[model samples]
Target: MKKTTSFVSIGTIILLLFIHGCSGCKKEAQNLSDSPKKTFIGPFMNEDSILLYVQKQLECGPRNPGSNGHSSCKEFLINFLKTKADTAFLQTFSSMVYGRTYEMSNIVASFSPDKKDRILLCAHWDSRPFADEDETPSKRTLPILGANDGASGVAVLLEMARTLSISKPNIGIDIILFDGEDLGLSGDLNGFFQGSRFASKNYPLPKPKYGILLDLVGDKQAEFRYEPLSQQAHFVLVDNIWSIAKERGSPYFIHETGNSVSDDHVMLNEQGIRTINIIDVNLVGNISTNPRRTYWHTSRDILDNLSMQTMSDVGNVLLDFLFTTSDSVY
Candidate 1:
């Protein structure tokens, strides 16, 4: 009877253990099989150090093309880039807006200048002078802080300069902090992407093998879906980046392709360079004010709403790609 009792107790223990194992397996499968997952890694962990730097730009007031803030920020940027880059230069040009010619500056920072093979990373640092997305028409003419729209992309590139300045990646990297991307009108549908157009036209260096343009990347739950044109033009680049995103476990890096956006990359593509825009295309119904931050071009685009997490997610994928990219490809 003692032996029988012992066998019964052992059987009960085995059944319990089996049930627990099956439950755990089911949970793991469900979690692992889900689409639209996000990832992170060591490189992105370092991005926190740069969020404040981005915020400081927002604090400098509106960096509109012709304002004192814009002039002051240009000086600050030239000084900052000089420290992290082997060479930094300003590309100046004039464009007529509403019959008034405005002087625009495109800040270019280069790392590993000696390496012939290079990749271009760019973002427009200028804040939009109008808050067209705002409900109030009066505020529509006011300049926006552009914390996420402008600064987030700049912040990532700035950190990239700081990081690569020391480590020195195998491939040459050009961080083109573009200007005047947001100042445009529908009457002339071609008014946007000014910096890229200028840079592509007057690239002092050999055309980079490829370019990655970042914009509006600071949503708390940001989703980076592949732009349709990018998919068609630079599918491999898109695929590689998506693979890295999957490996990193970042929440905002979605696997599916989203709508095609005509942004800074369009000019580069038109110039015969392979380029892709890594924009936040999570503009669904009501996720934000206009769904994807309808507050986009508004005064409401302040630092308080910016998420350090989103910055980290983008920075991680960018850094990994930069350091790991092969020189032969270029």
Candidate 2:
């Protein structure tokens, strides 16, 4: 049953490509006392908006990069982002999977494109084709809905984008929706992180100083343990965000480090972008955190598995992070 849980991590795989780097911005980090604007309003919070969005994607069926569902979902996301961001573009690229050629599009949305100081917030949009983690063998071939895993993070970012359009932030923001993340072939390190790898390699002019990547953050018991690679690369940034989460009394954000995960942040770090990953991998409780939670990568990763409270907590913390920065360069 746990065999699926041992599936390779995207972070571990991307670290091999980390040898390629080249960059930081000097922005004053403000404390909560000094930055009273740090206060965030939860009234605009709409977890259901995200839930509905996830349902819309699922209704298109599993969104593997080459599938019809993938094409339709990409259109939906691009159209929605156009309504929010100052500029939006679909970065089409080709990648090989299992010796077959397939095309993928990474959705890019920019806020305040002219601003020199910026931050990146990203999440993968592709759904895994194999529920390789499901306990039942019969379920392995079936596609995952990826409600919490793929859609939840994007949902939060989309909401934030909408809110930003209403009330502009001090700094520029880029919310990138990566593709081909789950296509990481077993034992093939180079295959994973396709979208991020492409973005980092050929970044649109004027890259941000730092970034935050969100993944699997809507679980009912969502507890964001500090990803090791993120912490190692950007401790101060990690500390700032976690401190805000703690101050807000958010039950979903945990201070401890969880098992190291391999996600899109690895590619950003490799390109010299100090990127942190915010993920919910249970590290607490008496059970061994080694293999981590049981629900991960399973067919159980549907809407019912998510918690609205968790989504709100993460949303508010990100809002707080944005507002706290009076200076443009966070």
Candidate 3:
């Protein structure tokens, strides 16, 4: 009887221990499920960091091609890019815009510059000189603040530069902040994309596998429709980005065709680099009134109009595409 009782007590102890061990395992598994999976290679884009970049650019004032703001912002960007990028290339050149000779610098920064396989990302850092789309005719003559039109895209790239500096992927990445892109008249294609045209004409070494140009991407109601030229240049590439946006549940990367924009990407494609423009062109500005996002080339393009969420959504989509893709983006 004593032996039987002793055996029963020992069995009960083992059962309790086993139950406790199983409970711990269940809790551990639950925690693992709750945490983000490590399979995604991209860094978590800091929206605050992105916001700071935008604010810094705007503080330099309207970055018109030859204004004091332009000179200060150029210095700021070159200094900033040097800190983040592995190798910085200052592509300085003289260009003629509106019958005036202006000196421009296209700042190109690279991560893993030695790698032959590369990807290019670019944006126009210059703001429009004319508020031609402003409601008041008098205001039309003044310059724009360019919080969204110029700073937003550059802010995204700066954040990406911060990301690459941290956990750089196996691929080579080149980021170019172009100058003199917004100095042209609307009807004339020849004058615009001056920095891009110059860079393309003298491409610093071989081109990347492909490139993405970001423009007007920081509106509170930002909507990135696929530009027609991007589809024409790289149909599969456009599809790939749109598909990634959908998969990531990004609210603003609408899977639709946007208006044909004669942006910096045109020069890159003409140079045979296979680049695409990711611009929010829903900006329907009338002769007088401005819609929510239709403030292009206007003084209304202020810092308040830019949204941190919008910037985060676009930046993350790009990061996921470049970092999480099973194959190369080419």
Candidate 4:
């Protein structure tokens, strides 16, 4: 969710591993914008329930690291996941970015942990502290609401969590809610993806078959593209997902080229997990703002800019992929 310069989080579990030097230790661990066309009638995804999750996150306020909102949001997610996941734990980490130290946690919820094969679904929960891309310079210091930027992805995942919990999937599932992801400045890849980097270097669970990252998939006119790195890293995997998107009748899953973002998926792929990201880089363009779509990392990234249909499109597509795709490919 950090402003894209075309590329790229850590949490506490890895920090303890470093301090204790334990190998057998256990640990825990975006955006709103999308546009989906066609009548996608799916029993698996509930738009109203998904939208409610987004509203709850917004009611907690901006979840920037070290803030009360962040703390409350973390508790809410863990509590909710506890009801849905087989096991849930917190992966905490600390680091210094831009000369300031911040403490953060990555929430990990495991489903069907006994199954060897798994799929990773990830999204960052923290909102940008500075509206660096705001049109108004005076409002640049204000925090972003992240309705489409942060909560959209989570809302879809939360709905999926509930769905999968009630009716289990064949393969194991791991949904990672990363922290400190939007804390970096544009083009500063190292400062961003703190939680993901830690997860990559210190995988708390079995390596997933592959991963799908959802970001900015809640916009009214959301569209997804084949990321350059994802295409380069896993050719057939890209085709497989886009094909599923197509088969699911998701107009937002455009099988075209997209900007090479340094997001959470990039870190996972770097860890040899072969993950792909499905994000809507063109959100603010279609989102109606006072001066057209307000840019990312802006003060205008509030809940009013989101759409429930967009959430359903992305969520239902992933549901189909998970139900249909096989582990033999990965």
Highest lDDT model number = 3
lDDT of all predictions: 0.77, 0.77, 0.82, 0.79
Candidate 3 global CA lDDT score: 0.82
Model 1 agreement with the true structure over 114-187: per-residue lDDT tens digits:
88888988889998787776778889778888887788888888887887777766788888988888778644
Supply candidate 3's per-residue lDDT for 152.
94
lDDT of 3 by residue, 1-330 (tens): 234336646765765666677986766545543443223556868999999999899999999888999999999898998998998868999987777998888988999898888888899998888898887999998999988888999999999999889977777889999998888777777888889999988997568888899998888877789899999988877887787677677778998887887789889898899988888877633322345566778778898888899988888888877776513556
TM-score of each: 0.84, 0.83, 0.85, 0.84
lDDT for model 4: 0.79
**Model 2 misplacement above 4 A:** 1-44, 283-293, 326-330
How many clashes (backbone N, Cα, C below 3 Å) per candidate? 9, 3, 0, 29
User: lDDT tens digits, residues 161-195, model 2?
Assistant: 88787876778889999998888655566777889
Q: Give the Å error, residue 58, model 4.
A: 0.3
RMSD of 3: 11.7
* lDDT by residue for model 4 (1-330), tens: 112111211323444545467444323210101222223344479988998999999999999998888999999999999999999889998979999999998889999999999998999888888888888999888888888788989999999999988876688999998888888877677888888888888887888988888888887767688888878777777887786677566677887897777788889888898888788765533353445455578887887768899888888877766765545456
lDDT of 2: 0.77
**Candidate 1 error regions (>4 Å):** 1-45, 283-292, 326-330
- Winner of 2 and 4 under TM-score: 4
Query: What order do candidates take by TM-score, descending?
Result: 3, 1, 4, 2
**Candidate 4 local lDDT, residue 193:** 85
What would the TM-score be for candidate 4 when compared with the true structure? Answer: 0.84
Worst 10 residues of 4 by lDDT: 28-37
lDDT of 1 at 37: 33
